[model samples]
Structures are given as C-alpha cells and as structure tokens.
Target: MVEFAICLPFVITVTMAGAELANYTTTKMRISQLALLVADNASRIGSGSMNAKTISETQINDLLTGAGLQSGRLNLFQNGRVILASLQPSATENKFVVKWQRCRGMQQVTSSYYTATNTTNLNLPVTGDIDGITVKNHLVTPPSKGAVMFVEISYTYQPLVSLQFLPSINQTINDSAALTVRDNRDYTGGTSGIYNAENATRSLCAQYTAT
Candidate 1:
C-alpha cells in the first residue's frame, strides 16, 4: 500500500503535466499560424494601383473579421487578442509609424506592438529604435517605398491542472508575424476609407487602444 501511495502522486503529476504541455503547444502553434493568416491578408488589400498599395477602412475591418474567424479554432475571442498594425514609410521623416491599428479579443494591446515615432519602419521590433545597436534594438531598412503588415496575437493560457501543486509556468503566450506589402501603400485609409462596422464587423478598432 505504501509503495502504491508513493508512485500514485508521481503518476498523477506526470499525467497532469502532459495535459498541460499538450495544450500549451497547441496554443503556440495556432497563434503562430494566426499571425501568418492576418499578415498575408493585409498584404493583399490595395487600390490596385501600380504606384502604391493602400487599404481602406472597410478592408481593414473585413480583414479583422477574418482574423477573428480564422482564430475561431482557438476560441480566441474568450481570452485572447490580435493586433493588426499598418506600417508605411513616411516621406517626410523617412521612417515608419503606426499608420493605423485594429484588433480583436479582450486583452489590452502590448505597448511594444505599435510603430514608434522617429522609428524607421515596422521591420524593426520598435520602429523608432534608430541608432540603437543592430544586434539589439534597431530598425532594419524597410523595403523602399513599400510597407509591412504586422500581426501580433496574445493569449492567456488557462492551465488544466491546479497551479497550487504543479511547478510554475507562464500562463501567457504571444506570437507575431510581419510581411512587406506586395506593393507600395498609401496610409490615408486608401483614398476614402470605410468607417462603419458594417464592412468592419465587430469593434476591431475599439478592441485595443494604442499606447
């Protein structure tokens, strides 16, 4: 009986740990793919102009709706958030700033998610990290006259096992992806943008406030 008692806890622990690990891994993979989906879609929205690619407010809303739908597999709406940022280079400052942003989910957007003023472009983790060490925080030269679609997904993981007994682990997971626009883009909502949620669907712009 004592031998059984000694091994029983270990067995239970292992089983619980396995379940937790499996869920964490699944969430990671799903969030990563989610980023890819949103970024790719963002790249395609344009005015069909040879000179510049641009996205309208309606298009942005539609893309956000699709993001929410694509993320349905993860039940992201219940506990996660996706932030879509538009990165376009400014002719005046010769750098990129968060032209605009939209989101889904209930979590507050991370401060690191936005394009920083004085930052060169979205390729850099922080767009305004000019003159920083290249190895650390710094802006890569954005594609000339082009832009990037940046997607960030953050989720709070709810463990299947009780933390009171298990080893500590972070309960948050986030993944991001960025892709250059196939063509140059205009930042002014693509020459007359859409405002109502009809094209937008859901309160995407209201989901996260830029900090």
Candidate 2:
C-alpha cells in the first residue's frame, strides 16, 4: 500500500531513536559508576594495610590506574577522562578546600560542572556529613579531622544510531562522586608543606599534573 511505504520511514526512525536513547542512558550510568569507584578507591587508599597510615603519590597514581581498569569495557582512557580531587577542611572553620588534584585519560577532565575552590573561592562551606551521601556501594567515613575524595568523569559518547531528523544531542557525558577518607591522611605532602605529592613516581595528570 502507498500509505504503508510512507509510514515505514517514520517507524524506522522512531526505532533507531529509541535504541540510541537506551544506549546513551546506559553509557551515562557507566560514567556515574566509574566516578564513584575512583572516588571510593582513592578514599580507601591505605585500607587493609597496617603500616600505611598516610597516602602517597604512588597511591594516587594507583587509584587512577584502578579506575582505568574498572572502565576497561567503557574504553574510557581513549575517549574519556577522570579527575581526582582531595578536599579537606581549611584552616578556617565551616569551610572546605581542594588541597590537591590529579587526573588521567586522554581527554582532559576538570570539574567543569562546578569549579574547584581555588584561592578566591576558599570560603566554600562544608555541607552535611558522609551519611547524607548515598551510592550503590556503602561509603566509608572520612578522617576524624575531615577529608573527601571528589571524583569527576567526562566522556565523549558516540551514538549507536545517528538520527539526522532529530535535534542534535550533546554527546559529552559527565558524573561526579565524593567519598570521605576513612583513614587519617596527611593533608600536607609530608615534606612539601602543601598538598603537592613530594614523590610523584608516576604521572596521573592528563594535562594539569600539578598535584
């Protein structure tokens, strides 16, 4: 029938759109999971080791490496990025500051959704405690003094099915996760006086390798 032929194109377009939407949704969830896993691993850097009281630059690198391993299926290193930030209570009460940061993967990733508190934005208030935050895995506690692993992951998504008829959707996907350090971590870089790791044995930073 003539009408059947006309309707076929619309039907095919709708099916393709649905499939693409599903794939995008799954990709977004994977990104969120990757962020949480990296943050959790970073927060638990010294866990299960009796002598390891403080986190080291090597541990930071290892955490990022673990992130890459977890995202093997996602092909994150080639197409995405992960940023790991250490947040701690500033000298001033009721405030938190990003003590140090490291990143990995090809695509440079920073917390673009929200800027990290730099010198000018040092007065960022500390919200509620770790119990308020929830994810699939139960979170660990922070240092008694207070420290957090803030993670952000960004990935450029390639569509499974391209729809020329539909309005173009931005393929960039991002997610953030925060976890409190369960162990007493050295806020200072031991001898460095700042958060910059004195012994950066490996490079985890993508472009900004300062921390």
Candidate 3:
C-alpha cells in the first residue's frame, strides 16, 4: 500500500503534465490555421490605389467580418512598419505591403465568482494583442507602363505559453515571420522608386502589438 501511494502522485503528475502539453500543442496548431486563413483572406482584397483619396475602413472591416472573424481582432500592418488599423493608405507607388495581427485568448480560467470551466470563452484579455503570429500575402497591382506593383506580407509569432516548456513539448514556435512579397509583373528602370516605396512601408509597420 505504501509503494502504491508513493507511485500514485508521480503518475498523476505525469498525466496532468501530458494533458497540459497536449492542450498547448492544440493551441499552436489552431494559431497556425488562423494565420493562414487571415493571410489568404487579406490577399484577396488586393491593393487599393495609393493615390486614391477615399479609402474605406468599412470595406476592410467587411472583409474581415465576412471571414467570420471579429473586426476588432484584425489589424493591418503595411510594409514591415506601419500599423494600418484601418486600411486607409497614403499616396505611394509600385508596392503595397501589409500583415495581420491576432491574439490568443485564455484557454482555461478560474475566477472568484465561479470555478474553472471548459465552456469559458477562449479569447485573450486584450482584443488585438497579436504579440506573435504569422502574416503573409501576395499583391498584384495594376501593371504600370514601365514598373510593376508588388505586395509584401510578414508575421511575428510569440508563444501564448512560456518558451520554457516548448522544447519539452516538441513544439516549435516563433514570434515573427520574415518579410516576404510577390510581384506578378517584373520591372526595370524605375525599379529604384519601387524599392524605395517598399522600404518606407516596411519601416513604418514592423512593431509587435501585445494589446
């Protein structure tokens, strides 16, 4: 009986640890799927004209809302730098860059009013806290006479759970994705202009949002 008692705690601990690890793993996979879904949807919206004076936040919101995600949960980042919370754009030429930010909510919770429950909402405390995530897109703008337009997408992923347990759990997580873009048409001559535009966009949109 003493031997059984000694081993029982160990067994329970190991089982609970495994359960935690599994839950974390499932969350990681769901995040990946979310990233891919957002990126794919954003790319479909295409790049609106940089010179066009009237850009609609409603349209952008509609895009996200249509995808069945809350508009409050989506953030638009341009280049690698600018956080275009609304899809309003300033005049530019040749390249359009953007990323999406999302946050993971609490998986389980305990509160003073109630005990821990599985039916609790799994949304983060803050809405737009995409501290770590992947955002990717490809944009094809109207082919200019001598230059082509391109779209760039980037992502930064921070684990919702602590990094200390990631390796032991066999999960690989990152806080960010390298900036990447795809252009449908090739350009020459005024290529420098396009490159300069892209650089500016990237510089403005490259920070992570924890909230």
Per-candidate local distance difference test = 0.62, 0.64, 0.30
| Per-residue lDDT of candidate 3, residues 93-171 (tens digit) | 4332112222222211111111112222222111222222223443323223321111222222333444454455444
TM-score of each predicted structure versus truth: 0.73, 0.72, 0.36
lDDT of 1 by residue, 107-177 (tens): 76553545344233323333442321121254533565566677778887766666544357667787777
Q: Please identify which of the two predictions, 1 or 3, would achieve the higher lDDT against the true structure.
A: 1
Candidate whose lDDT is highest: 2
Model 1: residues >4 Å from true position, as ranges? 47-54, 92-94, 115-141, 163-166, 184-211
- RMSD, each candidate, Å? 5.6, 6.0, 15.5
Q: TM-score for model 2?
A: 0.72
* Ranking of models by TM-score: 1, 2, 3
User: How many angstroms is residue 9 displaced in model 3 relative to the true structure, after the best TM-score fit?
Assistant: 1.1
